[model samples]
Target: MRTTASFHSYATNHRLVFGDISSDPKTAIAKANTINGGKNGPFRAFIVVGKVFTKNNFEEVNGALQDGSVSVDLPMFFTDGEGLPEDSATNQTDVVDIAPNVTFLNQWGRLMTDDFIIQNATSGSNDRKTAPTDILITDKWPSNLPRLSKVGFAVPQTAERATNNDKTIDATSKDASPLYHFSGSESFWEREPFANEAGKHTRFIGLAPFGGKQRWHYAFTLKKDDTSTPVNATECPYLKEDKVEEEPLKRANEDDGDPMAKKPRIAPSDCFLCLSNPNLAAHLVVSIGQESYMAMAKGPLLPGHVMLIPIKHNPDFCTESRPSTNPRHRHPVRFVSPKLALELRKYQIALKQMHPGGVVFYEIAKAKGVHVHQQAVPIPQEKINNVENLREFFIKEAKECGFRMENNGELRDDQTNYFRIEFPNSDPIVIKLNRQNPKFDVTWPRKLLAQWFFGNKERGDWRNCSQTEAEETEAADKIKGDFETFDFTR
Candidate 1:
């Protein structure tokens, strides 16, 4: 894995140089001296996108380091490349200080200057705090980051030889990919720097490999405000379209040559909580939102017991890993969108207002056949004091269950295995459970508390006290009457 370190400073204009170099240290040093001699001389740094040292080139590298004429004054950074010798002292995470001002960026790392930020595409730990990056340099292009370049490069199937026809060029291009400089592929030339899709005047220049026939070196002046505008839909032209081919329909004659043959049908989900199934009591629905709906619990933990469930089937309120190609790849909160969050909050507020005794939102995300739902039970005014000890009890119970409690009560990494939120006031008390424990059940907290307060084991399970159609309808009518005026949309 590769890690990144960011350095930030303020400056009006900063000049940085970029180029590709091989194991020949003399050439690397000469290029630096040549750039120094130019009007844009004495650059902030020199970024080498290829191998800095080869297995048999230690003598030349050592001679360059010893010679004062070839000494590099500005910081020189280089990433991993083919033919580079492995340093026993430096690991993937550790950056090697080769010379006075030259640094090996390892497999993956980041370098930031007053004018720009440079990052490599190796997965690793990140510094707790960092600044935004301007330029991204990696061995292989990152599929997730904003595309700042108009040209796209991909390795051809036939690696024995490089061909221009194998590379696809899009003349009508638009993207915000940063000024990316990369090597290790077939060397190509760009006559002029191309502007980003955002029309921010930011440019991308691909540096050809060292000793290539065409241009191999690149240098440009960078301004503090040369940053790209945020990428929009039209700007991201590199997004791949999902091509799902429809399955061919089978002819009736194919099935034993019988036109009357019937196709196998999928059975409906047996879980009554799933709204899609016939077993679900639609009459119990109290309020419906875009992403979630509220319904009367099958068995009343209390008269106002309600379940908040997502409209779509979700196992739990935890962060899910999505493909990089997806625009919504980042983890969400309880719901996938802010609109869902607002809807849920509205219901919570309305429920609390209807039952001022106080509402306790509890969820057991690990239950079998569970369609993620939170059990919102209104606590009696007299039992409000007992609820204070509830947090302490659960903390002790979690420790006994062999799960360490995080100091912060908030969800960790968006994994909401078991959590209890007290309404009206106070922060939520969340418990991340150990999924490996077969004996552990997330529902135990709510079940035990219900037994202690209501003194009815049957009340803990909704199935134990199933309501008739008439009874469910009555409960739903009463809930709707109480909650209709409090709808957030209104």
Candidate 2:
């Protein structure tokens, strides 16, 4: 018997994570360059809308053009709202995160362009109502989208004017772009399809471009960071990459039994996690980047379990060799550097791609002490969307364990000691570990994952599931092979 392999009916939109609002186009481009494994090998274009941003704030969009990170691309401006007078200063999220045009209609069938005005307009109220036309899709379709025309494939022939409120028809222009709506050909303007891959769209799912929001849409692609130069502080004065803030690695408390939470101060030479440590398990190392490395977990909760470790002993993933030059006698703790962050992302994405199902990441970050490393485990595909679940799960499990877990929303990276549950497509759920109780189990995440994955909670204690050195080597080799394409170091 022959069988056919199945694929996701449509592509899923993955959001480009930008920490905060920035007017620098270089920062946005730099962030866009970091996405990997989304139906295509790399994204050729990215978009930034001028809505939630100041009116006509095209600084980053224009900056992207000047930096040569992207080509000169025209901005598509969305028409105004269908009212006697649509508000000019509306706050909207017009940035469209497109999914691949896998399905011809996207369950929208053949919605009309003026469907909104036709259904809602009242008679004798205003003489400015324009009759809406229809746009049909899902008929005879093309093998791909954006036909020969880079401008548009399905052009919006005619549409509703910004001053349309029914009753007496206002003098409408013969040539107007279709009113932006959730259905029909007008909806196509939001996605602005330009074929680039076999499946999946580069843009994450975004709102706005919905009905009304005057926006001059701008899109630009990221240049390969390798070929292009890095965005230095010279370009954007507040470039975070240029900053170097390090802290002294602290020794674990003598009373504390959890070894992962604390470590010795000083240098990599004395740290077990460092390459200089003679007892380090070299065979379990999967891939090593310039600043960071990944290795299979000593006792994996599952087959592909791994740890993202810095090449040096420090937890913050920064290295300071010239400590003597500093006026201060101590090393300031630098947060995750860009290179390290990219490597970490590549590794995490590599694991997620390998699993086909998604992956889960949990970290116990003790700022002052310990080699900060996060443990990743492959989870079922069904669980990937349940982003808020980890908090409730931990709360329930904590009560049974004779302890408590806080759904701490105010936790920041600078703060020490916290448990973080993370997913690729979702916001991380962070729970601050209470220092006073001392009842929190360090291995609680391991145990929970063990129960969910292996159907055996005992495996949470690595001792119970520990493998031989040879077996570990084999597991590492398999993972290394699977991750060959995804590994950025390779």
Q: What is the C-alpha lDDT profile of model 1 across 72-142, one tens digit per residue?
A: 76778777644445557455443567778877766545554434556554422221111123454545432
Clashes of each: 7, 10
What is the model-wide C-alpha lDDT for candidate 1?
0.53
Where model 2 places Cα greater than 4 Å from the true spot, the runs are 1-267, 315-334, 380-391, 399-410, 424-426, 434-437
Query: Lowest-scoring 10 consecutive residues by lDDT in candidate 2?
Result: 169-178
Best by lDDT: 1
**Tens-digit lDDT track for model 2 on 1-490?**
2122212211122212121122343343444454423343232222222111223444444444446655322111111121111222222211121112101112111111111111111123211222222111111111122223333323334342112122121111110111221111222333332211111111111122323232222222321111222222012111222111111112222324343333434345435468786546788888888877888887687788888887767644433333334675354443556776787877777778887767888787654544678788877555656635655675577677655444444455344556677755556665655543355545677878767655667677664455667788899999889888888777
The whole-model C-alpha lDDT of candidate 2 against the native structure comes to: 0.43
lDDT of 1 at 393: 58
Per-model RMSD to reference? 22.5, 25.6
Model 1 collision count: 7
